[model samples]
Target: MSTQFLKLVQATRVPPLMGPKKRAASTAEHASPLGAYLLDARAISPGNLAKALALQLREDARLGDILIANGWVTERDLMMALSAQYGIGFADTALPPHDLDMIRSVPWELCLQYTVVPWSQTGGMLILATSNPDKIPQIRAALPPGLGNVLFTLAPEVEVLKAIALGHGKALARRAEAKVPERMSCRNWATSLSSLVVPTLCIVLIFNLLFHTTMTLAVLSLLACALLISNVIFKGTALWFHLTEDKSEFHSHRDHGSQTKRPIISLFVPLFKEPRIAGPLVQRMARLDYPRELLDICLIVEEHDIETRMALARAAIPSWFRVIVVPDGTPRTKPRAMNYALNFARGSIVGVYDAEDAPEARQLHAVANRFAIAPKKVVCLQGRLDYYNPRQNWVSRCFTIEYATWFRLFLPAIKRMGLAVPLGGTTLFFRRDVLRELGGWDAHNVTEDADLGIRLARLGYETEMVDITTHEEANAATWPWVKQRSRWNKGYFMTWVVHNRQPIQLLRDLGLRKWLGFHMMFLGMILNAALAPLLWSTVVVAFGMHHPIMTLLPEWAVWPMALVFTLATVLTITLALVACRASHLRFLRLWVPLTLPYFQLTTLSTYKALFETVRKPFYWDKTEHGAFGGAEHDVQTPEAAGIERKPVIFGTPIKDTAPNIQALPDQLTKVPVIKVGTDGTIRRIS
Candidate 1:
């Protein structure tokens, strides 16, 4: 027999494989025993086979997957051994040319869901190639009719996925870009424009008809003061709830039974121009305590992002990790990439993480355990996020304190109040079925996380907060921080506009109390930051400086305004300090008072966000990572992996090396063929 199994190992790829040395064919080639065949062929040692079998029983995974994940045998070798064992054939050569009609016969979505691709035609029968031959029966049953007789061929999972993408990438991109209903999407320009334009014009017209320009301005200033006070009051209520609530729920740990079988969990780590962090990312993910066979970590990269692709190519990616190359398309945002990658996930649970995240080791176990015990309506679990370099600088310190206050105190309080929880971007896990049923995400919404949370609530789903945390890099620098904050604010503004487009419907979807809370959270956040200049002008009265609105205001209004300002300040400081203490960051309590200056930075970011909301609503401001050397790892440099580093130019057109795209000849080359029946009986044809 030829050394066909060795073709499965790709030398230049990350997580380099060790192919078995060529030797004589096994004497038991005609036998149908997988372990015995591999051992006879010297494909795997006996010890590795025993270990893999034990893991297979423990994880409830396939023996092949366990061995492949552990690097004991290549995927191709396993498939080839299975071919010999089951009397089937292996599709060892390059994939055939795109048969558009054949591809159209079966839905690519179904193909992705089952890991199968209609490869080619032979003997008037369709040949469906799959990485998972064990699922052939299910795939056969689920496939749409009209393709006469079908046969199955074994191929590597990655190769099958790449072929499917190459054939249907554009369609997938288009669908992913607009998966959310048009009514809920911000992509509808007319609706977005009317939502913003009508509100502003009416407010202005009302002011013009009722009062003079100066009085109108004073009224607007007073309105800003009122909204700020309302926000303060709302937060105070949430703070009270947080203080009064039992701490046991906040710190409780999920008990994962010793013998409980954990389901597979897939995490999507989206990367754009992030070249340097790939090595560290792999290092961080390797720390996860989830079983190797059950952990599906896909590195989501754009098809044209050659820099990141090269970085991934250099890193030592494990055998189980998948690099999903998202086809280049419009509004190249993170959510869109995730939506496209969602089809390829192999887990019942799905999650998302940024490139720089280092989640707790037992985070997956906690999520799985919680999901196992919690009600089905609890479809999502959001983990707390902190900064890995909290004390890097004053900016970092303030940023950390802000996060502590929100994730540790305010968000939990909001959840307890039964309001829509605007999800943070990272460390969020969801039930796969519910996520798909909701059509994934609005790709056009820059803040897809928050939008998804609201959509879940509208559909009567709940998102519980998991106690584990994932530490991320803090944006310590000034310019980067502004850009990042602006993106988030822009997302919030867009989410508010989209959800409020049909205000009556929104009110119906979310009850009166939640509706009020939603407005207070989104609109209040935006207005407070946008109108901070007006509110800050009142500080001049304290210093006896000439103040515009404060001097013109009546005594009754003045006293209340001064009192509200003092109360807001005291409440904010107290919440931040208490949050720090709870989060075991008591040292950051001093930085709480310093956050007053930090809060001013959002004024600049809010204006920038407003500008971007009008100009480019879907543009994602990619935050560059590796600034503070994440997670304290001594990672390998790109040069060490034989790649020269170059400065990344934002928005530059990426060159495509476009590897492994060779087309096979019309006829099969040395690959055997077979005939399969509707009942999945295999009969050798060649």
Candidate 2:
């Protein structure tokens, strides 16, 4: 054998042969013992044989096939060895066709699985050809009753695989056909009618019955007041719990002592249209601190997104990162693409990120550590999301404030209070098994993240908050912001409708408190957005026109209505201020007074979302990122922007450093002093 072949055989572990033995009396003793004979004849090395045996222990392939695949030994070498050792003739592929009865004796599934085929049968003996001839005894045991003596012959692995494919084509097709329907079925009409149509009809009927505008205004005001108060109560409770709760308890402290045992993490980044950020996105992912070998990062791109594909091709993506092309399907939504990629995921823990996301480098490590320490019922973790481009424009600034308030204050409060956390769209990690059990993402739900969060609660699984940040682009433009918010509102509508299809069942599953929380979070948010403009209009019209609308209301209702509106406004402003302080965006405090006007923008999206909910419930209004320049412009930190950092105390960061500093005693305070350390440990030098 050539030196190259020998080296190849050494690497592949082709079996060695033993010294020839005296002819055995029993036929069982003659069953293909070519490996030992080859070793004895110096056709293969002992070390190679040991290696092949070690590989065989771990895999389901035969030794000969392994050697052939590795280019260590030829088929002819194996054929000659088998003939000499077994004292049996090779079965020619050109032999006459076997009877159909003989062929049907072994099932096609068995043929495909074992890579064996029944070639011919003669007089109480069935001749079988297999790449793994040594497995004849096992194959015979699997044959149907009434089959007699089984004879085996060796065939090349490639030829065997080809024959199996040809013979089992129909069976394979049937198996494939069984899976397509599940992926294709995306719509759920029962949810549509109950969630959208009935609600609309009820609203119209109530408005028509009232007839007069005064009664309608009173009822709308009352409904809006109730929603506002309920939100205040919920938020107040969350803030209270957040303040009192020992947040350190939620942090996982488990050390990753063993590198080998670290679980594989599958990250799915669903990309569409915005190809300009692909290279940067890949670079950001590559910067993750997790072991590259254990990270299965899949960039899910739609089949029709040629520009993104080309962009990715041009980017210097690492070998481990995969670009999975999602096949064209209904809804063409992010969740649909995610669901498709879930099948190809090869990790125990799965995470999702967006194209523009730049998650904290240690996020995967934190997620894995949390999962390791979390209870089995805790199946998901949502990381905090904030905008890096908050200073881009007014819209972006307001958007960041809203996000910071929700993520930093509201979400933590929700988690601390033990309510379901309506998950954010990205930087969410899930237990792979749990995600699959929940059927992954609902392709037809535009806001699949929130829907999935509710589903997790309904199924008795908990989603915890991971203390990591994933910075993404804040929508800086009007139309794009409206479209994105509309999709979210629409998805929330779908989730509420779908889960409420069987109200009693949902209530039973989630219990009364969670059921109520679900409504207040999903339904109440929608109500707040939709009713914001109407309520603001009432206040504006009543104040500006000297009580034009207020005059129509009953004399007794006017004072109470005014008081309710005043209280709601004060509480909302307080919440915004607190949320801003908690989120370390004290700069947003200046904009807190403009909360009403900021929320008025939401009305546009709410109405648009309502229409879309009725007309095209599953339409995904894609939020195009990279619009406000690139990642570099979007990832600005507050400290980098010359903003002073404050220490967090009791879930709220201090607003000013000035208050903590005491003026030096009159004699020693003559000279100016500067602060240096984070703890405010000052060094004064004159």
Candidate 3:
């Protein structure tokens, strides 16, 4: 899988390799050369030739050969057209004087089929002769034999699926759409039982107590349950839609909507204590194809962390790059440092990446090109993020699958619905000034990206997708991953609080549809993150403890309710795996089943994070990131110095949950970097 396939399919006209105004030759560009026969359009019809032309994957293929192979156009018509254009009779596919490069470049199939006008031939000479007569004459003059060709021509419109079908055959096209039933996630399921979904039983109980009529309460509870059921249905639908790949852009009518300027992009990398990730981070950043002068790649560090600062200063980076230091004492979370960087950033577009991420090279280019052609109304593009070390262990595999579903399937579907997309923690690009207009990152909010996206949509900017994906380091072990997820889960809960704090304003800004979507996204994350685990564990307990779920119910209702719950629980988990693609049966044997129980740690960790959020606001757990390198790691602390790690920085974490999070002082509980103002004024909060 060379990424070139995706590149060719979705490429937009990029500025020249060197500058902003010059354009590169795109997949759609046409070609012309002298000393070759000129194939005329009259020789064949586009529709008839299109079928055969599709077989030739090569960009340079003979137009006449493809049309002839497809059997829609005639060799007589092509020869006549070529003779008229080049003043020579149509001859066998031969390299005319001065057309050697053109012939070799053209697909062999196109030459054989068009130049010889054959009905059939050996599978050799792979090329699709198209209906375009102009291309056929060129192929005759340019191409040589031995290259097999398939006949084809451009159609009025191509069904991408149709082309895929031609390559894969009828069996695949007839394959059934997935129908997996959702089931409980984790096998043991303790945390899931206690937390997450506020139980349906709780709803029934509330109805009984609040209204005091058994029948009435039952009916009311059923109605509430119906609403919950509907919510679940909608969530499933949302998740389903994103699984497909789409490149259409969101647009609007505007005066200054021309796609001329190549937006200046600011890349932000939020660095914490994980110095082992520096090399990967730097490499990913450097690998980006975006012009160096146009890119503002910032390696953000805390002012108090001498280690991170030293590593950054010593790292080789472009002069356009910078190390922004936030003061050590205000908001300890990542969002705070981003906010500090936002004020000084000078790019039209802004993006955020984690210290351990290595995004695909074309992401920035994709974002830019997508924006250029997209409906000018969108203000942000969310690229996908997956695990770089997904197979590191059972824990990493589960996390990777979960992330795959979220980023690949869930997020894209949400974007399609025109809802407020949750800005992922990384691979998010935004219009810089739009971010500032909405008041930069929320210094107080832990999940700044999600909150900012919501606020931006509310403030009249739209969010869309570039459909680009990137890779990030997966938490190597269960405990560490849980700790990290717990923090994120807690931050999402906080995001809900801040937005709902002013319900009236929210309603006015987002309107009902958007407001509903936002509520679902916000509450959905919290509820799913909570309830899925609870349900998982409960099912296990019911089966294990023989808790008499049906025995406790009324005789008439026992079977029905039990059946429904059991069915729904199963459906939920099954869908979870399918939507997420939790390894095929083969991979499952090696990766999934063994890791099932541990995956529930998400619920358990979430609960821990819930309490931690209340007890210690702005806790910054220093994620330990060196298991891959082992003793040979870089960024080691003084204590680790005697071992293999030497060049890496070991910073004092603010909310230290990992090895030394607790050691951070109360005074240094916030952000750790600061920047001097124009008058040389500096704030020493850290």
- Top-TM-score candidate index: 1
Across 1-686, the per-residue lDDT of candidate 2 in tens digits comes to 11111111111222222223332321233222445545544566543443333333333345664455444456677765665554444555544233555565778757755668776665657777776655767777887777667767666544554454345433433332222223212265434355456467658857765676665665666677678778767766876776686767555432332222347688999999968888888877776665443567999888789999999999887755888776565667888788766765657899999999888766876787777777899999988898778787888788888888788788878877777889999999999988877778777777879888988898899988878888888989988988988988888876787787778998898988888889998889888988775566666545545433455566566567677778777876777777787545888889877666777878889889888866777777888878775555433443344433322111122232132223322222232333223321122232
Tell me the lDDT of candidate 1: 0.76
lDDT of 1 by residue, 1-686 (tens): 22332223222221101122111122122111466556655688654654454344345466777777668898667776766554457675564537666665788878888888877676677777787876888998998877767888777777788778878877898889988898888878544463465357558858774767656556667778888889888889989999898868744545434344467789999998888888799877766766667789999999899999999999888766899998888889998999999887888899899999987766877787787777899999999999888888999999999999999999999999989999999999999999999999888888899999999988889999988899989988988999999999988887887888799999999989889888888878988998788787777667766555754686566777889998999999988988998546888987789999999999999889887876677788878898775735434443444432211111111122212112111221332233322322222244
The global Cα lDDT (0 to 1) of model 3 is: 0.52
* Model 3 CA lDDT for position 305: 74
What order do candidates take by TM-score, descending? 1, 2, 3
In model 2, the worst 10-residue window by lDDT is 1-10
Considering summed lDDT, which 10 consecutive residues are worst modelled in model 3?
176-185
Q: TM-score, each model?
A: 0.82, 0.68, 0.55
- lDDT (10s digit) by residue, model 3, range 1-686: 11111101111211122121211221112212110112123444322332222222221224444444335455555444433432222222221112233233443334323332221122333222223344555654554565445432221111211222223222221221111111111111123232332344457657776676545434444443444465566656765664454434322211113334445678899887756566546655666655443467888877677776766666666544667666565446677677666644646788998887767655765676666666556888887777667666777777776676577567777777777778887888887766766656665555667877887787788877665767767787767777787777766766665566568888998888788888776766566555553344334434545322233345465355456555555544554565555343225334434444665576686677667555554566656655643213233232333322111011111121222212323323232233222322222233
Q: Check candidate 1 and list the clashing pairs.
A: 15-317
Q: Which ten residues in a row have the lowest lDDT in candidate 1?
A: 645-654
Residue 665 in model 3: lDDT: 33
Over 4 Å off, model 3: 1-231, 243-259, 528-556, 559-599, 626-686
Q: Name the candidate that leads on lDDT.
A: 1
Tell me the lDDT of model 1 at 469.
95
List CA RMSD, all candidates.
11.6, 16.7, 26.9
